[model samples]
Target: MASIHILLLFLSCTSFVYRCDGACAEPESDTQAVVGRGFKLGCLSCKRRSEVKATATVEWYFKAKGEVDFVQIYTYTEMGPTIENEHFLDRLDWNGSKRSNDIQDASIYILNVTLNDTGTYRCFFNRILNYDNYEYTTVVSKVVYLTVVEKATRGTASIVSEVMMYVTIIGLQVWLLIEMIYCYRKISAAGEEALREAANAEYLAIASESKDNCAGAQVGE
Candidate 1:
């Protein structure tokens, strides 16, 4: 009996993973929940891919870590989200649109998240789309991967920190460019001074030779 129970649990978990990936043909959503903090599960159905039936239902399922079973957390209809699950009875709030006739924006807000609430959540919309007198029943879904943590550190840089970082980088680049220019000018000036000295030396040598030749001609005369 224990082995049978374990097998059933394993199948349930595997089945849940398969269902979350297989049935969700719509856009996906994801979120994070810090331990003891609140978070939001976002789902948008704006300009829906298809028309919904008059009596459509929205279902939300959750699969926790190390667990093979997917729990039916909450559901929504024209009335609102039904708090049927014990785990999310008081913690779940309907943050989605209240339009049952045309259900869209199916988001949910979770309060006081705990480590046990971390899992994969899948949302499904079972509707009968109108198609030229034929009512086609279809299921559109979105998968939300929610992670819960016991300790969450704020890793996002503040606005001032980001601005300062950019400023520092730009300053370093400008300083490097100035240094390069200064070095180039100093090298060029040194080369020009060496050329000037060599030219003066050559001119003095030519003048001395001309005087010596003049003295030799005078003595010969």
Candidate 2:
């Protein structure tokens, strides 16, 4: 049992590490941003095979609300991040992969967003996969259409989800409380029965001993 517990702990730790390294899940970016707040443009391009080593560079482009062409806004490579557009200078920051060059998450963040910032943004990834004898290259792109508003509004779906989550939590707590009460009552009843049986056995033993003493006295007489 001890060895089994140790093995289970090791497996859990391994799974946690694997997920932390990269879960490789792609979630859509939130397209609504309130003015004067920060917003993150999410983009993830995961490698199909993790065993193969790879290096990647990311480039971000933006088109203003009524722009005819998309302009390069930012780029992140091994050399580091560079802001290419004057409009987003010092406002755009890299919010994605770090420590290694195998860029999977290429998201970016914008500080103090404005109505002028509302438009379509594009994230492009150039990845080079390294094999034993050869190297392969691939390109991946994702786009997000953003709208800036003065005040944030919660969607009906979001409200419903929150209500459901609270309901589920309350239900689980009630169920757990009922189970604990049931177990306590069962154990208490069993303890009471055991004590009663012990008391009866003691009484019977004392009576028998007294009767034997009386018989011995009568014999002496």
Candidate 3:
């Protein structure tokens, strides 16, 4: 019975760890956006193997800087490629004609682009998997930075934006370092307190036995 209980506990802990590590989660792809007026932004796979199942829906969205509106340019569903935004209707084309749910070789072409297109773009997938008697849905999102510029002059906005972003990242790193140092100190203090308590308990036990021995000796005399 004890062995069975130990095995059950081990399996429970393993399951919890697996779930915390994002089991059945859709993996994200790396995105790169270039500043050339007319260039293609490519999405590369971090890993070689294609683990995503077939019949997943992939969608692309473009959001201009300082704009709340999200323009849906391309969407691949079971029906076919549906293009909603007229501005990108002619300019945007898939690099590859072939589309597979498992393989993500999606690329977008922007021709005769202007500076207004500079913003963050994202690619995501809504995955549905049928298991046993039910279906489950999971969403995965990845972002890319796109900066459009003139043919002759470089845009200062992109550069300034990048610098500010780096500064914010550095600030986060500093905060994390401070938090780690604080936690280390707190843990060390707690460990010392535990050791002190154990030592005090040992001394008290020895003192109690010594008092009892003295009383016994007096009684014998």
Candidate number of the best TM-score: 2
TM-scores for every predicted model: 0.53, 0.77, 0.45
State in Å the error of residue 168, model 1.
15
| Candidate 1 local lDDT, 15-89, one digit each (tens) | 999877733233555466688888888775543554344446778888988889888988888666697689887
In the range 80-181, model 2's lDDT, one tens digit per residue, is 999999999999999999999999999999999989999999999999999999999999999999999999999788999999999999998998798778
Worst 10 residues of 2 by lDDT: 1-10
lDDT against true structure, model 3: 0.67
Assess the local accuracy of residue 132 in candidate 2 as a C-alpha lDDT between 0 and 100. 100
Model 1, C-alpha of 117: deviation from truth (Å): 0.3
Model 2 TM-score, 2 decimals:
0.77
Off by over 4 Å in 3: 1-37, 44-52, 96-99, 130-134, 152-221
Ranking by lDDT: 2, 1, 3
Root-mean-square deviation of every model: 18.1, 4.5, 12.1
Per-residue lDDT of 165-202 in model 3, one digit per residue for the tens?
A: 99999998998798778878888999999999999999
- Number of backbone clashes in candidate 1: 1
Winner of 1 and 3 under TM-score: 1
Residue 27 lDDT in candidate 2: 91
- TM-score of model 1 vs. true structure: 0.53
For all candidates, the clash counts are 1, 0, 0
